[model samples]
Target: MPHTKDELPDVLYSAAQVRALDASLIAAGTAGFELMQRAARATWRALVRQWPTANELSVLVGHGNNAGDGYLVAVLAQRAGWSVRVLAVGDPQRLQGDAASAHAEAVSEQVLIEPWTAQSGLRGIVLDALLGTGLSGDVRDPYVSAIAAINASGLPVAAVDIPSGLCADTGRILGDAVHADLTVTFIGLKVGLFTGDAADVTGELVFNDLQADPQLLNGTAFTARRLCIANLPRLVSRAPASHKGKFGHVLLIGGDRGYGGAILLSAQSALRSGAGMVSLSTRPEHVSPALSRIPEAMVLGTSSANQLMGLLEKVSVLVVGPGLGQAGWGRSLLSTAANAPLPQVWDADALNLLAGGQVDLPKGCVITPHPGEAARLLGVSTADVQSDRPAAAHALSKKYTAVVVLKGAGSLIAHPDGRLALCHQGHPAMATAGLGDVLAGLLGALLAQGMEPFDAACLAVWLHANAGEQQGKLGRGLAASDLIPAIRQLLEEQAPCLK
Candidate 1:
């Protein structure tokens, strides 16, 4: 069984992919029954370690291999002198292969097996073995009722494999899923466990590899990588004789009349993140205020696309849509930026405008969209984007021919070349507005500092989330501007420059 602290292998498989892997392993000489036994033993060990004092177990067994795992768990508990009762939701006679063997073993061990009932007195540590990862559509009948009863039982639940009803590929709950206190997943870690609603439902996750053949496991394809500090690109120091001109200039365009703060935030973050020269093209009314707020940035007042064109020549990176309103001025500025050949980072109104088919993206651009923005860009409903974020991100990347950063609970960074990474590190307090703008600026800074678009985005996401987490510890009302210094501090801490 793989422990939580163990380095996650490169391969991350979805439920369907893992099923195919299981079949391959079986075809390659491993018996199907033996694999099932390994799953049960791995689950049992995780259960005992998590709840050592629990002497009784209520196993909710369903119709498939998930039920087989539950039956084997019941037999193991019974042998250990722990009271075990299996509430079978499906007919035991219909069970086939390894599932039938498990049922037979449970029956022979004197483990009580009874049909699921509403008032089954399901006490003690509940083991949810109902649906597993194969479930699609809505959850049906007895399993739904059984899951509800288990939740209401006030007992800590250990879910075998995945919590029943979770889409192993998307992390979306199909109708309803078991709310496990700890889920012991076997064979491989499912992508669903880390994203979408799975984070809430699958608490205290534990992975068990079942001691599968290393060669087979290594050969499987991964869906996405889990983002962490360790996986982030290494930050490089400036050369001893390097000057300000050595780093690229970053041009930030946005901040319509009432939204000046958004662009200012982006520009400030870019400056803090190491852009050589940070410039802001915003509403004429806010120019003086923006300059006063961050004198290091050259704030320009622009009312037309022509004004923006003059500044584009010197910029290496362009960050658009911070506080960009959907007005004529915002649209004109966006059109101007879209025509530029420089690398770009698009956020907020830029994404909304793109969704409306008003502007074409520049080549080598990065679009940072929250779910709503992502949904708009993809021509799908927000529900669709949230339902399967990884797929949505990939779709966005492929459609725009740009690096896509789908921002939400489990933020995803997708490249056009089929590389996808998931960042599971931010806090709930990060649910504030303007943070996405800050991220765009950070990306621009990294680009200005000469990182490739993909690496710049990956590192920026980690740095932005780390800053949010650090500021979030200071309590609520974490203004977007507060993350600026924190990001600068974190970057220096991660990669300090010599004086």
Candidate 2:
């Protein structure tokens, strides 16, 4: 499994799509106020489950339905005999629709409500209900100060819907966002929660649909699909008569001078990931060590583009990157790969060379770029790419007309046809060198086996992330070579060769 989603849905939506789904539910005879109440109850249940011993609740409310949720949660807290108070950041009188009704209900329950000030104190578990998906621009005014106070309070915080000041579409933090210990979301999962800056602020995510009917959600459009076992690309089972030539051959080219280990890591990963015949083309000096490391692979000491001619003719797929520097050797090799019409996986120095405008990327290519390389390729700052990763991935795919794998905390795979998939499983300890090299090779092997470009990228990303997660449990000091064996085991578990 990519991620252990017990009951969490795979579909991810922009805030607008989720709102449209909510509207459709309302149109199908569910009242808007009733949905608000269900959301409040779900939040209340999650809050209590998160911190049952906390006998006090401090809820921050704004002028929208998010405030309605907070007000109703305050009612639940007060009736349960817990000390509860509402810090009305947005004036309660300005609340409209179901929010106004919730305010009246809180007033009737005698819940202590007061205007928020810089000096206001928050005790017990804090509920961030200041803003939901309605936020578009940066956070303003007293709300910023209120959010800072909540973060500084050092209490267990539960955010209703989403944290205030975080963009629901891009996951970009607007000014500042509440760092909640738990966040209980409603209806559908937002794309913001899985990518961009969401991982830094969203902790312990809990999804509640507010009990919306499945019939009402069938036809709703989604922004992206999360990769999981059910939807991952499947490898066909091997027959008893299967031979070495059954799977396609892969040619991996890299390793200029000082960087020899990166290409070997990739070659070993490709061999382990089931490439029929893995060929390594590297510096003449690396030949002995490469042969010693991975004897199962055919190691070639390639110093110039002429050295790769015969091998390139036989190989069906090429992985052109990883340790390939900006020198003439790397440039010549990458240029030759660019001219080949075969499927290719470009990564590391290959991506850098493409960004340098030296060579045009070939068709049937999958380019794996981290934020920095993506920014260089897109001619934007790294901050701009990270600010909206999904958009950057889409733009890169459209520009190069190749399947793009934007690698980061949450890796995105975007196709030229507008299909987007996301990989949400990864570990901080997996942030080591040569990991991208391994990913490039894994993607190459999948492509060599005849998976579609988008599907191969999605499956490779999921396997690489999950393997890193499995190995990262030992804490730090995780080496890049450690992922190869783990990836091999996971691939077997996911798509067994013997069926």
Candidate 3:
């Protein structure tokens, strides 16, 4: 949470794990009350910085330590000459230990405390302290109504720790969740904050350790590591005399009529992302356009599975599924690629074809599937996939014995051995068409360049997402091709070609 020298805090903790950490710190001589006070102080600092001009504050208090944080924040604001009110949704008498102490401190400070009602005056910036990570079921009664009211109040809400009603372990919204304008988290980073519905509800995320001992956290196991530029895998510098043969050739197969652009985008992306050579095998009708679009790539028009055999043998990596129709031709190509020993990247209709149980995915390949494709492959609904994306990603990786890229708001790259990486980058503009095709190609290029399957997937996903983030600032109508140039530039910056 707090930046410690020489340590990049990338571990993501679950709700239960954070509690274990709290207990660990407490057992190690730090009092629970001390941690509570620290959490409150961190929240106060963040709230004041965000709403410095607001002279009034409304703190929604529940029965947990989350509410205790709200109470202490109210005390801080009241002492700072800001008018503060505490709306106690859960009875203050129900609070125990540190939370009760916090409530008593607020009362001593004469912070205006009142029972929450449906018509409670919702004024000033709202502090959502109604729920905590302990919640496991759907929110019921007063809390649900309060969360709904807070959402409708149009007030800038600052959620303490995490937004109420959001699953801390899975990032799923239970019934509903408070849409906070800002959320200040403590102890360790919760995996929920960056994935699934949490991304929509959690505004700007702020973290603090309450300054807990860094060594204590090292002993704890994390749910997943949040992928950032600092911890991302990087490619080593290439020699000046490096030639085309040094980097592996990537053969892209797909583009059944009307989907020619998909394969072209993949081929072009592979070429631009440092693949030594790129080959496109598609319908005969798409040959001219593929050649015209990316003159650097060898365009081959293949009609049957046999034609793909030679191409498959010549390439080090194979990218399948970009605009690959579910017809016989696409099936034939996918079938051929499935048998090849080359490293593979599969997306689009290829995922659908795999879901249909027609083709076997090759070992040590990478499969990128959005939630919809993931659900079909897992024989579940999209809602089920979204409910627990990390689990879904791990499931896919083990099921296929390949690296799995679960593409969505927060893309997850999962290895068959249970290692998982979450990419919290990318922009809304990247929700356009043909991006997955580009990603598959880029991933293939990395694999072809001799990066391991998991490392290549992680690097490619980060590069793809970061490129979209940079290009998305231009606003809207972002085509898939716009990302290729940006990705090329970013790759040079992230993984320089020179020593």
Candidate 4:
């Protein structure tokens, strides 16, 4: 059956961890074949639920337990009077153990089986049970051709365990991975299913533990926690006599000559997201517009580091680099903010300047970088950062000694000590400009309000993405400012004021 986001398990595991979990279950009395059969049953159930009218199925089977599951699914389809055929990519003669038994069961059930070939015609809904988690390198030969054909086919496809050719550990596409409309993963939710290229390949994800032992499942260690509103760090409510000063002030620095909008968005977002007092330090020319746009913000126009130092004395948190250019004016302001002892959130040009070695990341700060900026910070190509985001995030966190929020499709929040969290919600509309500026401001607001760096980053990310998701439903043209009010409402709902 189709599962809701909240219904899926929170803990994500590596391929090896999942295999160990499987082994633990097998060693504790459940036969490996029995587990395979359960997986097939679960996949069959989910497939039927997703497309009940698609009576005909073309099952692509390979070797290993994933293929065994496919063969059994074919058997179930045949027995249920649905037109079904199994195209074995791996030699049926080479099938071993439980997989061999499963193939024999399909044969005994009179299921049609044929060898996979480039010329082979595919009909009905395709089942991509090829190349399980065991595959480590790039997809080679006939399998690559088959995957290409399956993708070339417009037919709806369901992948077993994980999508073929998609790395179950890193979510990197090995050569080319099968883009499944529905992926039925079992035992544990693989980390790859939610990050990197997983979003491009894994369409509707369905997870079934196959009734794994709760004691064993709970005991299994996870690579990272998937951040959701239900599991997010909670914020305490305010007292009845509380004043604006109780929430703490957030000072946002950056708005060079032509980039006033970036800093304005950040300041407005900080105010809306619960910062007690939000201050904007920008170019002198921007003072009137800044106040006109966000009257609640305390606008301070300063082009020099000395002027910024005075403002720094009164703020609790610093959010730098929204419209911060690498020019002399931006550099001076950033230089002053960098030496401040306050907690900080750095983004955009601040990251660029940090990458250029002009300034060092302050301790107890949160740095938000998209792939491009991350590449600069890490001294690698953007492809390298995208290829393995978790590693990049961890490296950045350790290198800077700050919480790192690697913002992308599956946004990852990494702590300096190695703990990591991934945000699974974000909309295409969030790809607009000024969003990162808004995110930096939100991060600063959370930090000023007394959330830990890592916790603030995680909660801020969830709020930013979820608000984008909410506002994005209106369809396209989602402004960065459009997210602020929605975020304010959602934040209050998540961490209510009267509690």
Candidate with the greatest lDDT versus the true structure: 2
The Cα error of candidate 4 at residue 120, in Å, is: 1.1
Q: lDDT of model 4 at residue 16?
A: 97
Tens-digit lDDT track for model 3 on 280-299? Answer: 89999999888788899998
lDDT of 2 at 380: 95
TM-score of each: 0.94, 0.98, 0.98, 0.98
lDDT tens per residue, model 1, 1-499: 1123435553467888889888988999889888888889888888899998989999998889999999998988888899888999888988999999999988888899999888788878899998878887889888788878887888999999999888899989888888889898888878888778877788777776777888887777878887765667856887789888978899999999889899999999999999989999998999889878899989889988898777899888999999999999999999988988899999999989998999998778999998998888888899999899899999999999999988877688999999998776666677798898899999999998889998898889988987988788787898998889999998898777554
Distance (Å) between predicted and true CA of 16, model 2?
0.7
Ranking by lDDT: 2, 4, 3, 1
- In model 2, where do residues sit more than 4 Å from their true spots? 1-6
- Segments in model 3 whose C-alpha atoms lie over 4 Å from true places: 1-8
After the best TM-score superposition of candidate 3, give how far the Cα of residue 392 lies from its true spot, in angstroms: 0.6
RMSD of candidates 1 onward, in order: 2.4, 1.4, 2.2, 1.4
Against the unseen true structure, what C-alpha lDDT does each candidate score?
0.87, 0.91, 0.90, 0.90
lDDT of 4 by residue, 1-499 (tens): 1224567877888899999999999999999999999999999999999998989999998887889999999999888889998999999998999999999999999999999999888999999998999888999988999999999999999999999999988889999999899999999988888888888898889989988989899988888999876789967999999999989899999989788999999999999888899998999999999989899999988868888777888999999999989999988888888899999999999999999999988888899999999999999999999888888999999999989999988899999888989887877777799999889989988888889989999999999989998898787899999999999999999999876
Q: Any residue pairs clashing in model 2, and if so which? A: none
